[model samples]
Target: MIAAAWLFGVGGAILVGIGGFFRLARPALLPEDLRYLRRTPDEIDAAVPSLRGWLRLVFIVLGGYAVATGTLTIYLAATDIRNAESSAVAVLAVTGASSIGVMALVNFALHSTFRWPLSAAAALWIVATLMAVVS
Candidate 1:
């Protein structure tokens, strides 16, 4: 559980940093004088119609969920399970690390292409966590 918590926390932090960079900081940090060099007419047109406000809202929501998921794992580490012995902890560590790896891969892939699958990865994480809790 500790291992899972750590992996999830580190992964979530990286994701939050990425989301902040793209959704919150990048536009404001870009030089006003050099902005023209950053966009073609088509790019500018595409950007202009984008609902960035909505996108940022989504990022924030996902960020919150990531934080919660990571934190819950930390919380789990503090408790003993019903009928579980020392081996359960080791099993949890392996599962947690594996899940975090999967989550990271999904995130990396989504950054370049389809994003709907991110939700699927998140859903899997939630289901796996629930299984851990109940088992």
Candidate 2:
């Protein structure tokens, strides 16, 4: 169970980092960005100068969240979760559902190219959830 927790955290952290880097690096982050917007970053900047900055800010916040999620998961695993505390199980479940489940849903809804990989990462969430329950 602890190993599963660590795996989920590491996988989620790596997966979440995708496109976040490109998002701030002055390029369209994902192909979905262009597919959904139908415009390049330059076009977006030309039409709405502040929009890109706002997006960057949002991604930065997401980046922070990515870090937090991984850290929190591992921290929980190293502590209360190992003892099979109900509260720890509940907390971990909530975190996984809110973060990985929601992210996977959004990617699927958007037909994001990253959807498959993100779904794989979310599978880890499910595995961890089950292990937590069985433990």
Give the Cα lDDT of each candidate: 0.47, 0.70
Report how far off residue 33 is in candidate 2 (Å).
1.7
lDDT of 1 by residue, 46-78 (tens): 766564456556666655654554555444444
Highest-scoring model, lDDT: 2
TM-scores, one per candidate: 0.41, 0.79
**Clashing residue pairs for model 2:** none
| lDDT (Cα) of model 2 | 0.70
Provide the clashing-pair count of each candidate structure.
Answer: 0, 0
Compose the digit string of candidate 2's lDDT tens values, residues 1-135: 666556555655654464355334533256787777788867877898887667777777776676677677767776777666778778877887888778889989888886898788788878877877775
